[model samples]
Target: MVSTPSPSAAPGAGAAAPVAGTGPARPRWRRRPGWIPAPPLRGRRRVPWATSAAVFVLQQAGTGFAAHNERAAEAVGPDGAARLLLTLGPLLLLARYRLPRTALFGTSAVTLAYLAAGYPYGPVLLGVVVAGFAALVAGYRYATWSALGMLWLGNLLVAHAFHRLLPPGGDPPGSWGTDLFMLVWMVALCTAGELARVRRAERERRQRETAEAERRRADEERLRIARELHDVLAHSISVINVQAGVGLALLDSDPAQARTALTTIKTASKEALGEVRQVLDTLRAPGDAPRAPAPGLDRLAELSEQAASVGLRVTTETEGAPVPLPPGADLAAFRVVQEALTNVVRHSGSRTALVRIRYGAVAMELLVDDEGPATGTGPTGGGNGLVGMRERAAAFGGTVEAGPRPGGGFRVLATIPLPPEEGGAPLQ
Candidate 1:
């Protein structure tokens, strides 16, 4: 059964959307609208071991401080209370990093309470920032914002009330640039976080665009190749079809001439069929379809006979024997001959043609010449077929020549370079 391609499966199914400011369009990776960030790391080790270590050290410091100065440390409850708060800070941070919504808000709440009741402001703020930053980086938006708000608002109130009481002794509000410095620092921190987030988003956007552009280039190349194949098949098939119809029309009226025409038609039809199959096979993807062996230089004789059957008096000359050509070179030689024959019936408008293959030490040359019009007219215009043949030859490092012969007919001449197999210079 012929499998028709789906219209929806056509190339460019879901085109990428417009990019910011418009160069090429951008493809969206995530199906959803919001940022679905990287999932948090797993395992016990993924926990912030460094923060855990710091917490342990703080607990030790607090204990040592209390032991070193029981009266003074107890008076302010610095050693005992601060040590407990600092040690617990990392445990919370570890939990928060691993589990955003849960440990995160809990840590923020506990830290705020500890901070207001004489916990070290520096340690408390450090823990809050770390936890909040984790939430941001992980893309747990609501969890992070709420946590930061709670921590910062608590700090804001505490900072204002103790604006002059920070050092524990009464002092003027202007000391240490109190309100002004704090305000500037908070704004700066917020700005930095936003910028980092933007940079990350931009990077992701660029990555998606690059992937889509590569796919487009590949699709365009495939289409170009398809056009080439269609051109070849269409031109050859048209000639074959015309010849077959003429042969059938004269079948009983003129048996001898009809036989000749039928032979030519058979030859042309076979060549056209082979060429069509080749083009179709090329269009199939690797592993998507099983392929027959490709026609190459080995099939030169068959190609020549097909042309001869079409009423062209054709011949070929070979030299230097055959060499093992790279697969691409072999196919190019075959295609050049096929197109040259098609053009012979086309432009030369002749009943006779000659083909020659000269394999030298360096390069291989193919030449096709057709007798001028039976009525003695000049050869027709060299069409896109001629140009296409030349191009195909050139792809395998060959050059082509075509024009009416000074002797009165059209000729297509080409010399294709051979790749070196051993320590010899490559054919030019």
Candidate 2:
């Protein structure tokens, strides 16, 4: 089982780990203590060929310069084999991105062998530094640590235990101060590698979070558009269906009435088309002003007229002085009332509905009632009308209660909380 950090541990302690078959792990802390901040890497693509060539040229020139100095006189001068060893380290760096551990170990081994051969040191260790950094960033923290440890151990064995077996005849045992300095440099390099690993992990995590947030926003917008289309189509189609039935029944008995029914159907279809086109325009060019203003409670009279044309008498009554509402609340309230009355026309045996609007100091209530022995084939809970009404009201921190009334009718009540600016003086 993989062990995770405790709750009180530092943030990002449990970043993604390397999977099996990718690399070996020790199952301890991946990010060591004492973070040293590294600047963010600018580019993603690793030009391994370019990097390998650059490092090889720089190391050859740098080592030659160091060899000419008097300080390296005690060290063995570069020869054919020493130059070959120096070349090997940089060549191994070509595989650093794809196989970081391989590059690190190969470079470290070649550099160690050169030191064991008693060659003057300069930029020869550059390959090991670069490979170790890449390995840690690739989530091979333990492997990097082990490779570095082996290099340090190899240095100790060469300076003390295996010096006679190596080159530079009559050399003294290495000083403790020199070993201490090398140790400090290794620790610093490892510290730098750990910092880079953590920073890269953090950057990747933030990118994933940003992408997830965008996905959720897209899902919500799609759902909102779907609800809008459903509301628009359901009511308009119900009206058209009723008018078409009336026109069919009256075609032989009353031609004028049949013509009237056809006109109603035409008007309903035209309005429905206009609303659908407006909704579609939002998709084609979002953030542009809508070609038509959205429908709201101010259009309640128009809604009542549409219902009346289909043999449903809708009586509307206002209890308190009305105040302006936010655009979202106004649209939601209108849809709730529209869907409620649509349900009445399609499902209820009674041809009447009563709509009541009451305005309070900080809330607006809409109550739609229809006397009914539900006669149509529509299912009460299986349709989208009630669900859409509830979702809309909930979006504005409101509630929708829809069910059978206490006595004998179906009722839908939506209570929407008003924003502070829209909540006028208390109603009397």
Candidate 3:
């Protein structure tokens, strides 16, 4: 699935809409327009063998014609079998893309043989050069360098073997200037091939890094959504479940109390649905306005009221000078209190819960305690509530300790660090 980018989404804002059924939203730049011509639906297009054959014929014919017209004085024009052999040398390049190493070695060997057989060094060198480039681009570094070495050695051997075939007063075999020129030529070709290879390798490395980064980002987003779902569903469903049970138990005996329970259940379910909707809205088109602000510490009183309706009395107290907190830290603290109190109602068998919030110089601390029997099945015992609390605190460079109180009940303590800037400002 491919999602079109919203025109109003800011570049690099990561505001692209996620494609339905796709795991994560792809970057806008990676999305191409539908009208752009795509590659063949089948596999990659095969090499044009006929075009290669035509090029080879033209090159050989041109080289032969140039040599016959005395335009290439240094070239020893080959005749009969020698000419055919020289022509066949470059023909090996037809399979260069598919069989790079083999083509490179074959072309190099054939070119060497032709030169050694006293044939002219004409356009045949073109095939060797192309093969070398193909091998380098295919990442056959050792093969390319080795072929180049052999070619240089063969050039020297041929020059020595046919020294008498040279024009009058020509540079002799192993001449320093001639050797230097040949070395420079070979090095230049090798350098060009190496540069191309390096560029291709760098591009591939960057692509791999990008893919890994995207995968990690996707994993983090999945975990974040899971945490939000757990918090919303668990607390609301637990409240509804308890309220429903209460409503059923008192349906006939006490109609008024049962009606209250049903009302609580309805309210909790509606709130839960709204929060879930907000989370889902994140997947909407990027141009949409942001959802409502997340639930935070200011909602603590409201959360306590909800717990009270579920038969768990919660008292919230704040110590130290009140200070503003970052949204994430505030939300984490709120969830810790909310989850702790929900456990008190559902598992701790506690009648009353105390939630303490302390603003310290370096950290904001939260403590929730209930004087209930510790033997009940509470959220602290192998439940995701405690795990989620720890995850939340840890996300903000904080820590959470949750367990049974030594006296009779359960306790949850969380400490979230306050960044320097946030710590400096007191709540208005």
Candidate 4:
């Protein structure tokens, strides 16, 4: 059964989206909008043992120093329970990356408990700040803002209205200035977190663009190589196929004729091998020049000779003064003619093919026709030769037409646009 390609499966469609990560290693999962799934357990990041330990040490030492300096001001001094609360905040941070929302909320609750106990303020709030920053970077902006808001508001009520209901009774209301100071500090932290998120997003966008460009370039290169191989092998193999048949038929009857046919086959296969190697060299060592110059219309005489060896007579006619063509257009034009003649030999019953080239100021036209009752073997829209011709012509902003002519023969016509500067120079 024939399967038609869906619209989304067309050329240049359905390319794989670049994966997340900074290196060339493949990611375990793709990133998506709205939700990000965690990678497999084996791919999960290692627990940040050192970072959690560091935070724990800093919070303990910093809070101890603050308590010693502000003993007279603090409503409660360092105790076993207060030290445990400090340790709990850092422990929550160890899960910050894997579970950002939980870490943020847990650390905030711990800080609130310390404050409700009438403990001194200092780096005791550090764990919550770190968790809030992690949550924001993880794209939980609203949740982080809500958590920070609750922490600040709860501290306010505990220091003033709720102080009497909580620990260390008989304490006076704390100043509003202290709440304002906390507000300013939280704003600065949020600002830094937002900036970090923006930078990370920008870097990822640039990486995705770079990866997409590289994929497009690779696709184009693969297509070019396929076209080169098709044109080279198809034409040469057709000639060899015809000559081999002749050699087999004439081997016993006409030794000289058989020898000539064998010679033609040898030459055709050798040239095919050489062109194939040239195309492959690009893949083997990119950026190296080919051993021979690219073929152009200048090699039409050689092409005619090859056709003659396979029992096809090819006649050429050029109508205006031939001019210099840009290398790309020149190669494209040559391959179109080559493929056209190859089709004529394989599919046309007539032994003769006609080639017409008309060079104009703005464009160049090529016409290849055979007076043929077809051999029933021509391309029926499913072959690579015709498709490659169209692609090559389109690359130069040109067009191609191929079908049976009204006069009962197959015809291939191509038009390639030429640059303005090319109009002034005559072919050497």
Candidates 1 and 4 compared by lDDT, better number: 4
Candidate 4 residues 282-378, lDDT tens each?
8998988888888899888878888777767778888887888888889999999999988877877777788899878778889998898777765
lDDT value, residue 273 of candidate 3? 99
lDDT of each: 0.59, 0.79, 0.72, 0.80
TM-score per model over all chains: 0.50, 0.83, 0.80, 0.87
Q: Write the per-residue lDDT of candidate 3 for residues 1-428, one digit (tens) a residue.
A: 11221122111112111110113444678643211112232534346466457657766786677667653335456677566765675567777766778888998888777766555555666777788887777667778889979988877866775666643235346365765676787788888987887777677678779999999987877777788888888889877887777777778977887787789889999999999998888867445765789889999868877776666667777888878888888888888888887777667656678888888888888999999775345435668888888999998778999887889788999988887786743222
Best by lDDT: 4
Clashing residue pairs found in predicted model 2: none
Q: What ranking emerges by lDDT with the best candidate at the front?
A: 4, 2, 3, 1
Residues 80-100, model 2: lDDT tens digits: 998898889888898887667
Please write out the lDDT profile of model 1 over residues 136-213, one tens digit for every residue: 655665656666666666666765666455543442233246445544654565556556666767776787799899
Q: Per-residue lDDT for 353 in model 1?
A: 71
Give the top-scoring candidate (TM-score): 4
Please give the range of 10 consecutive residues that has the lowest summed lDDT in model 3. Answer: 13-22
Candidate 4 clashes: the total is: 0
The local distance difference test score of model 2 is 0.79
Candidate closer to the true structure by TM-score (higher is better), 2 or 4: 4
Pull out the clashing pairs in model 3.
none
Clashing pairs in 1: 264-309, 264-310
Task: Compute the lDDT of residue 370 as modeled in candidate 4.
Answer: 88
